[model samples]
Target chain A: MRALVLLRAFSRAKAHTLLFSSHCARRHCHAPAKRERAKGPRILGPDLPDIWRSPPLDSTHPPPPLIDANQEINPTIIDGNSIAEEIRSRTAEEVHQMKDAVKKIPGLAVILVGQRRDSQTYVRYKIKACHEVGIRSLTAELPEDCTEDEVVDSVSRFNEDPSVHGILVQLPLPQHMNEERILGAISLEKDVDGFHPLNVGNLAMRGREPLFIPCAARACIELLTRTGIELMGKHVAVIGRSKVVGLPTTLLLQRHHATVSSVHAFTKNPQDITRQADIVISAAGVANLVRGSWLKRGAVVIDVGTNPVEDPSSEHGYHLTGDVCFKEAVKVASAITPVPGGVGPVTIAMLLSNTLDSAKQIYGLNC
Target chain B: MRALVLLRAFSRAKAHTLLFSSHCARRHCHAPAKRERAKGPRILGPDLPDIWRSPPLDSTHPPPPLIDANQEINPTIIDGNSIAEEIRSRTAEEVHQMKDAVKKIPGLAVILVGQRRDSQTYVRYKIKACHEVGIRSLTAELPEDCTEDEVVDSVSRFNEDPSVHGILVQLPLPQHMNEERILGAISLEKDVDGFHPLNVGNLAMRGREPLFIPCAARACIELLTRTGIELMGKHVAVIGRSKVVGLPTTLLLQRHHATVSSVHAFTKNPQDITRQADIVISAAGVANLVRGSWLKRGAVVIDVGTNPVEDPSSEHGYHLTGDVCFKEAVKVASAITPVPGGVGPVTIAMLLSNTLDSAKQIYGLNC
Candidate 1:
């Protein structure tokens, strides 16, 4: 087992080096080719290299190389982890400055109800993240069968607490509890999750600004903008219509002056629509739902889906996967974000950013 | 001049008759033809009819007929005026019931600033509409140079007036006035225009309901549903992103399970996108921006634009026209709404409907 782990790590490192070198070469030698190729059919031809046409590998085997040596094109890998770290470091600096100037730091209060292991793990990550940025954190844990009033009371306490600059009620609250009622109890000023209808409405409207934007949606845009992708006048196809990610992302894209098309389960010929977009964002939550054939050549792909599929070789007997088949997309896209290290890290960074913003507003510090 | 007036009126009546008879015949004879043609290219062939090929007419000439004798297809004209009358009559009956049961009728307060002739005309029409439906109306006329505080005070007064179930602040308030601040001051319950961020947010979210939907957006949906058009899974292209019509309409279409593409000023190749939609809704506020070639052969068209263009032959020296070229679209679309009598009338009726609903909610009468 130890030898196998070493082999897998070595293979991954080798794959990264190959992809990076190829990506660099393509940028220098094929800039004009990329644009000309984008106008033609993106369907892979039968002459695909043996390595590119290989079938999916099992967890027992070492992961295949991300780029085939003989392949003519390879996408630029968007390193979300590095970007997230950059944001966190910047936020930490701000927090340190606030502490030095005013002897205060941002505070985030999280209310977690029920014992779902996933929810507990998520809360733990959030708390740890707060500590990393020098922000104070508090948690309210309730029994699985807690009453709606109990949850509301916890929110009320946080709402009234001046130290709690941001209040987040962990989602999927016990089935018996009314999610809307409890969420609505959070003060609008401290709604760091940006789930409040007023915040959403303001975000959707032109010339209006929301106090806070939803984290995942903000993460998607941050990834693109940070990568120097200009959104203005660009055509974007967002696959999914969930309130948490897809809907807000579409609205945000429109705010950036991108022509947006929302494709969901009911959409007929979704691939055809997606193939025409210059940017494709998939939040459908269906593992490997989007294929290379669904994308336009040289398109920028942002996969927000994070589904856990069973994998016995893993410690937890499962592994996280995204909506797109990464193997197929990397060959066709101009730039692509990988699953585990992509949107998830950036989303957490946005949460920290929002909390910091709330603290600044409360403390009357423009910075 | 009198003879020309009679000639124009007679010509219009004859055109309506021709369109109606042809539409009915095509519905019976070309039901299958419509479905088959939808898959083929929609461009007009070289053998186009002479009447359809005529250039734009001057005000002096009699308006051209809507259908040619040899034309193979004619769309079913959506009669917005008649549909609006039906809704208005229904609202009047509900108002009568409320008066009989509780001795109360819905009251609307309009705050009009400045002396813009168009704004004054719109306010006059609204007041007349309220009276037609047995709604009590009040107006506060302010000068063009009124202070922001004066506008806020007007909104505050209406907000406090329990008798006023709905409050409408006429749009395009003086350049010096802040529109957002004044509109935000209106009580949420009395925001009949549904411009409140909270209402818009709720409308955009799944499993959430807004206190009121914007009138024009609601009107667009009413026209489609009442005309027996199925929105579920349909591909809809919404041209424009205005807060009043386009934005809300696009949001509403998503709520109805339609896959929506928002085609805006920044959209590349807007015609290509519009041509692929199963339903095309133009609210760009640009007169005659959409031509016949921009439509699918059997697509449903909802023209929400109401742009006023100079017409010396008219009493007002200007006539209201929609974003679509009516003469060209009639031959391509499966169903269409005409300008002047299309979404304009229906939008006002929706306002009345929203006001009536507000009164019912406040009066504790669900019916």
Candidate 2:
């Protein structure tokens, strides 16, 4: 069924392109001014072809104008890499000023267990990010066979260390290890990942603010607001209900006064319901689960899905894909975030920001 | 605007009844079965007249058959009084059994300030309830001019008291006092109202269960589930997003796998959004805010609003009204809960149950 959906999405893209080209030929043939113009047609709705498609331009059909073309025909590409860099740079500046005043830098400790290559890569990136922003990095690597007690012991060491302002446990610990026990061992004040129950509770309640928000969920909303999408009174359909992402995102959205709907795996006619949203955020981790047909014509889409689909052409033999069918959706949606470059980069930036905030709080430095 | 909405609701109800009576005279003039029948027409759509009208039972047509009358007309009234009584009885039975096994009954502590008449009445009712259920009640009455420290000190005394299993501070603390500080002073173990941050956090996250949920929120879900309204895969619209009721209710409903929409004060065209819901739970605190026209035909409504509107005819000079315009809603909804008897009774029953559970946990008795 997954393969069928993928094939169908690709086929829809092809079908739309063919229909667009034929219609363009007939329309341009009748209007000489349109052929002469440098800019593309005003493609504001579902009639527009996917932005990823490169249509040939020659003297007869004269290439659609390059200037102002994107503004007219293309979906807004939310640039997470630049946004992440901006945040990181601001954090680094803050760190520089704090260290100069206090003679101490913020510190973050990470606990990792088992030797998953992906986990190691993520840890390396986090540590590197910390260093880039002038924060101290403390690492404790435990063996896969280590008991839950050993994991908790490592976390407790960091909890007692006054230098460590934040503690993060790389998730998906060894199968036998109890995750709750290990995560709970971290002190709530230094839980920069915002997975602690108290932080989550604060996030869920009104008039109570959580010290930190789960970075990924915060990044999603940050991207939207940074790009100037209005959230108030708008209907947002959240396509997942996971504690870390979906549920918290729903809470945050509702807090922002958006009429929010939470649609999960058990929801009936999920497509029909999701299509009513002015903004659709899919965090279900299901690759290409949301198709072009599942969205409203001008909906804003934030895809938090980072599932790996087998891709033989890639050097790694796999490629990251989002919950949305990008090729098909770009034509339908008004704005969209690409999979790997979108929420992932912003998420790391948010984590760094959180760590810095925690340190500032400890040092009594207002930011 | 509030008065306009209320007036419109009453006018709509009157119009529907007049239209129905006139239509009945014309349609049932020839049908003898119609005049003999106790049941009204099967009104199942937006255009149907309100079902509450009782036209004269003259011999225009003979009385219709009496069998299966309910199958055709009259919505199911969710008798909160009966349901609450049942829950209280069961709680009493559990309390009796626990005392039999461990010679100790559960205890509850309530702290009140400023002596609001309603608050005093509620507190008295709670103490009376505790006595009837074989539980002990402790009350601390503070003056309206009491300092914040005095309130905190009172909470501290109860927190240290081993006999007190649960602590509840009456809400709407004097404007000068900080509610969060006062509420936070309660020990997590004895925070039977479940207002503690950790408990709320557990409630928000999956795989983690809070020791208790705020009673009113739980009562709303209990009423629904006990009445056999399936929450899973259903659309539940929660009006209002207050921390005590609306927000927690939304969280609980989403956790139960329902597609939940949170409509708050900032929501635009709330009636339009509410009409799409299969179940509507209103806690907005505005009397007669939700009109029959705002609901979908056959929708189930759980009203948690308790507001007093001036009524010259009433002995108290005012009468309690729910957020829903109940008189108009009864004709439109499939099932509805009355204001005074609905969530109010269930809420108190839930409090008693929570106190008992706290005692059970403390005694290491598995229930």
Candidate 3:
């Protein structure tokens, strides 16, 4: 068990605030610009080759030029995709280090039902991202005819499995199936999705803290925090108050000292109120719903909507667009998250981050 | 059961909104004021109660001169004893009716530990108020040696008993107990205190309604609202963020369209931020804490603190004071709640209100 002492170093990355210090087995790291790491072979995402096979640099097939931390995160320049890739690479390094030390790999199970093409594609993207973060990926593609009992059984299996730290049952699970019941059934401990009532309650309250990692909401705040944006005393407008995204997102934003207004469909003259917001986050899933003038000038925009609209030019006959009218919004808003490239990648990164949290909690690192 | 119901109705001089609307064996359709209730019982608070509780005035206690509908709600002077009496009278008719129908009567359990003279006095006053409201009061005077588990187990037993709807385990439960654990252990369905996470979450989230009810925080807002002071679009400064009162209170104000800034001990320059607010509620439990100069002129203040100050002038050797410097604030501030008299009585009224909620939930009125 003394070998476990070596495993503790990778966990210390969270505490490395001022110094980029880490005790890696190998002189390698996996972020955008890999930094000094603990002693171990470098790990890659599921899509990438093992550390032994892949060379340090792919001079022939070069990856996209990484964005400098100093530069503003650009949406049009595959920002979401890139941020996600960077996160996965970092996770890969940690996973690889653990594997090198003879530890069972951390895993995430994604249970998808029915063929909403967008949802299916999302699962695929998540699977690819999971490997990048060094967390083993398990995908159970259930058919549209699947029973509630079957889904329940699978979640139970994942719950019992020591290897799996997170189990995500993709949203919009067929209308006939009870969504709340299914969501509530997920054990609070393993609910990395952070949609459980206890987690939401903890997030809403002052002293109580959620044990489950709030992936999407946390990602939005983390992106802003990492970007050095000061949130204290900022008035943030969160449009669309869904249980999954908008509501919890508002709570998290409020936690960081941002005065938040959650506007739902019923809110009269929502745009008039939105214009007052210093920060606009539209997770309504309505394509181009947030108009140009609806935004407050210089406001930071985070578009969580992944609504696919019909586009003749696209191969799939549809193009994914966010709730915000990006073209016009970008002109006025100081910064905004892109449709495909913004919040999407950050969600996966946070998921992996949560899995590691579960690993840490299981191992009793700090507690 | 039918005989008991009739007895309960007979006990009260007249029935109020909730009981009259829900449990009344027969409708008072002939009455003019009652005729307007074609939509059945108005579940909304205060407005319905004002219309329903019309007593035939005697020479001694004549209906205080006919005032307009929009006048302030302090029927009695700002003194705590007078306000507590006035509130009791408002619910007098309903109290009579409740006693008529159910011989067992509405009950509230007040659990107290040790002789924290202040807490003991508070509990004693609450028990006295219950009797005034025609409610059966139950007190569990536990020894200072009572373990956390013992307290929790007692609360659990009371929660299972159908008779006890509102259970208040007095705050500052002896040092040995974990407060959050004990509070969390109280069933949300029976939690009239509204300290349960579910209620807090519901209160914080936009559009979602809480089942148990919010009391102390709601009472603070109700005081301001009753005084014809609208919180909508007003900047409210909450100078605390405790789970019980401050945090939930701020969120409730925010939900009502008040731009709220919650400050605490961690907050630097709290008065600077509070000065910008139109309404100030200091629940930090610090006596004479909020100086007059810190307040914005014409700011409506609701002092939710029940801090005890050493005052040898009184027989008890201590006097209950508020978070505000009342003498200083009264000159600058347009309206302020006096420490001992203001929020204390309203808290009991809200407890009664929550019992009605518990009964309503059990009755499935909302569902």
Best model number under lDDT: 1
Q: How close is candidate 3 to the true structure, as a TM-score?
A: 0.66
* Strongest candidate by TM-score: 1
Backbone collisions counted per model: 0, 9, 31
Of candidates 2 and 1, the better by TM-score: 1
DockQ of 2: 0.19
Ranking by TM-score: 1, 2, 3
Tell me, what's the RMSD of every candidate?
20.2, 21.9, 16.1
Angstrom error of the Cα, residue B286, model 1: value is 0.6
Candidate with better lDDT, 1 vs 2: 1
Model 1's number of clashes is 0
Scanning candidate 1 chain B in windows of ten residues, the lowest lDDT window is B30-39
User: lDDT of all predictions, in order shown?
Assistant: 0.75, 0.73, 0.62
Q: What is the TM-score of each candidate against the true structure?
A: 0.81, 0.80, 0.66
DockQ of each: 0.19, 0.19, 0.08
Top candidate (DockQ): 1
Weakest 10 consecutive residues of candidate 1 chain A by summed lDDT:
A30-39
Query: What class would a CAPRI assessor give candidate 3's docking?
Result: incorrect
Off by over 4 Å in 1: A1-71, B1-72
* Alpha-carbon interface RMSD for all candidates, in angstroms: 25.0, 26.7, 23.2
